[model samples]
Target: MGYNFSRFTRGIAPGSRIFAADGEPLSNDMLRAAVPSIFATEAHESRSARFAPVPTVTVLDGLRAEGFEPFSAVQARTRAEGFEPFSAVQARTRVEGKAEFTKHMVRLRHRSLTNTTGDSFEIVLVNANDGTSAYQMIPGFFRFVCENGLMTGETFSEVKVRHSGNAIGEVIEGAYRVLEDAPLVAEQVASWKAITLQDGERLALAESAHILRFPKADQDGEAPAPVQPEALLRPRRSADRATDLWTAFNVVQENTLKGGLTGRVRNAEGRLQRRTTREVAGIDQNRSLNRALWLLTQRMAELKSA
Candidate 1:
């Protein structure tokens, strides 16, 4: 059973790994059995001031350029073994200045979908040492999830596992651009494991030049929205052009968008250019979900004029 907290106590204490899958307390033995080795000798560091993630662009946009794909893992079952590629939902992401990133181990269950019935599992991101400010990813977390005693394919990205619960995640296939995808292991009892980057992955990304790169996230309207005209997708085969354009535009935004710790605060001359819209036209939902918030404000004026 999970521990009942006192009114004086605010929340679940770290190391209190109660299985959100059920009410059972996740024991240390269970944790070790899932991941035999634990993060040991991890250097101590102070917490970075909390900052809400800007949006999904942090990983999505970057991965997309690297041929990354996303899916809603728990929402539908037709693609249980894969991704649905639709059923879009709002994206939430933020970044703080130079926060220390940590690696985490995940426990997985495969047939839990059939025998269990509901969501398979969720991703919990908290301090591996002491849990706090837990952030949720989505249907799942971690680049790799163990299924029925075997590891699923890996996601082409690695993120600071945030949150304290769990979510579903889709397995991604890609070149060894992401270190996690490398066929190397670091199981030294004294060392933390990490994936090494492959040379081909490096060359592929190096060839994909940045169309729009911003040092910091300027309010969307602060600068004119840069326009692209099939420069990247010119040789494109075929798909929903609108969705393509939208996703493409997101490609631009994700690649270009910067967040809080961006920009220089020199004297008063270089103050960030912040803009507020009174009325504008054609600000339809042409880009990605991450742009929704920015689009909302921009559209306020265009909508009024419409």
Candidate 2:
């Protein structure tokens, strides 16, 4: 699936329309009309005591002051029986020519808009009323080709702050640092581009990834079932077919995220059954898998350098 950065870009456009796709200014009126929970107060009552309320519009205003525009915004749809399926809203409304739709997560890309290679820096802020997750800010690169939000660093690289006073300042500052460090990311990508991968090394990385995706059985249990490493290494796009470590890593990463590669596994009845692999969709799993692939490539490059 192509990851559309249009959702990230629409918010930052010069004439942003964050409320309706019809091109209107993003305002409290629009937000409240579209999603009432954003403006809900204790007077409306009944939120869990643990709900650290971060008023969404307030944060957007702060971002605007700092020159960061909202491109996409969505409300967390209640899984409660009646309402239609909803997702975490993207952070901005649409301007005349911007993208459309909603999600609960608000994304703000760096205003500087410097492209390190084909990727631009972005920060995603996730807020939830259901107590399932904390309000947190994530830093990542938005790849133009595939529209993938490639996260940097480890799973815990996110900066989590309470919704209380100055959270916006902390978020802006954290994002500033993340964008400023884009050079480091560029350096690593450059190194990977320079490092060629031997067939053996590439296969080894693929084998490790297969294990990560499908772990071996417990010590006392039967031996783990087998899966072809090539299944995981297959390139999903033509651009990923090169022999360098960077290309290998991108191939693996895209395949992992895109899934659908088939493998045989033991069913509950101990019969071998062909099953399609699941896409890496959850926030935690995407981070873990992407970071693991990146680290694997980094290690290979380091070894090659030495």
Candidate 3:
């Protein structure tokens, strides 16, 4: 599904709407309004009898009992246009009861970790009742400076629980497993902060990110990147102007994901037209890009240390 990001709006990705609270736990009413799928009581009809249904609210309640409170919730909409019959059928199946089975993500923070300043760890929960997704727990960082949510690299293990018997128990277990790695994420951030990158190194990272965002042409050929790599290096705020690897990563990440960079692209008629990059809106796209960027930064840090 294509996703669109709206910085000025409540929605984060296209086909998705997000509600986040500022240092406060989101209420049931808030989550229901933003991502009703989280409150789903049953699985979609498409799922086979073998597919055990576990409501996300069950997991949320389980986490709450463990002192974790959800602050952000988002759900994917099943609306789409398809030309093929099979595609149309799939779309219909997804939309039939999408409100009860669509993919949703919730971000929660443990009460014990609340006092930490600068950046705080969040347990990002992703699930769907339509058999499209399993219970996924990923380590996320909430940056106070930019109000950005960042997923950590693969070095920080992601816990997943398949839709089956005892899934809720497994998910609750996985949440704490992810929580245990919070300090390690903080250590990684501190190390990145300490490693200052020269302008060339920063540019190299941006160039790599540019390629990730806009790949080279295939046999069919594609337009060049909408913006130069240097554009990604531009800081949104003074706090992000530092030359450290962490700051540089944030600069590239924000620019790449939030987009809105003005540039020229060749039209079908071969004329240059002004275009602005779109925000990374798809949940899968967002997570994939965020994780890839994190991996790139990790590799850069490793190379620098070596």
Candidate 4:
């Protein structure tokens, strides 16, 4: 759960990890080897490409040439009977290791000054391949103290590249955008930091976020009992104890997405039952949460502006 966040919080230098101390790319053979679906020889009968299918290797090679190196990789496993052989995998490589993953999501940060204090702008890239998802890059932030990975719900900052002949080119172009948006991103962060929430507003945000992330809880005319709103306010890490809007937002974000925060509700029998929420693991949940958080952040920003 803390795998991605811990690494990012440590601020692992891209140059340090991407290359050996002697200055060469670290062994990405391990990363490359994990994603055989992209290199599989057998054709996927269901997915016919308009152009020749671009090998994942080709995309990685192109990114590498541009100074990015692969650090982490993940692939979706297919359980359906016919789609057994077809799977989509995504590897995250970074420009000098500025991005860190929180449960497979990377926060791309941009800073204008070498010694600037306070928060910077960030984008979150969830390099995913469910065999259907376009390569998605969304704006996000990484909090140094709390080690939270936040997907800023700024729609204009989002970039997507379809799995086509131009996929690699599109991806490279998007990467450049990350570097270019430092000022705008940093400004947004400043706005979020300036906005502090009262306890009522914080809890209301949590309740709304609960429904937003877990709409299934409200299905079938029998809504799942709500989790204690305060539970969402509990910090996953000690560093996150601040009372500002950013900290308040992360409390909800982490609880909703990382799971294991306990909550209870009435069962069909009208008996109380407790369940520990799990991190959002499914690709669909991931996407939904990404969008939801982005929207929530925007709302907070607006509220602050108001």
**Candidate 4 lDDT, 1-306, residue by residue in tens:** 111221221122122111122212334464434434433322234446553333455555665576554433334333333322221221222122112211133333332321245343444444433234456666555444443345555555667776566776787688667656656766766666678888788878887887776667657886763576678778877767767776677677777766667778887788988876655544445556755765786787687677
Q: Whole-model lDDT, candidate 1? A: 0.23
Alpha-carbon shift of residue 270 in model 2 (angstroms): 7.2
Between candidates 1 and 3, name the one with more favorable TM-score: 3
- Candidate 4 off by > 4 Å: 1-27, 33-35, 38-43, 49-51, 69-71, 80-131, 144-148, 218-226
The order by descending TM-score is: 3, 4, 2, 1
Two-way TM-score contest, 2 vs 3, winner? 3
Q: How far is 211's C-alpha from truth in model 4 (Å)?
A: 1.1
Best-to-worst order by lDDT is 3, 2, 4, 1
Model 2, residue 267: displacement in angstroms?
A: 4.6
Tens digits of per-residue lDDT for model 3, 46-161 = 88988987799988988998999987776764554542222221212246556568877788889888645577788888888888888899888877677777888798979988
- Backbone collision count in every prediction? 21, 18, 1, 7
Q: Best candidate per lDDT, number?
A: 3
Model 1 stretches with alpha carbons more than 4 Å out: 1-212, 215-237, 243-305
Report the alpha-carbon TM-score of model 3 versus the true structure: 0.89
Q: What would you estimate as the lDDT of candidate 2?
A: 0.55
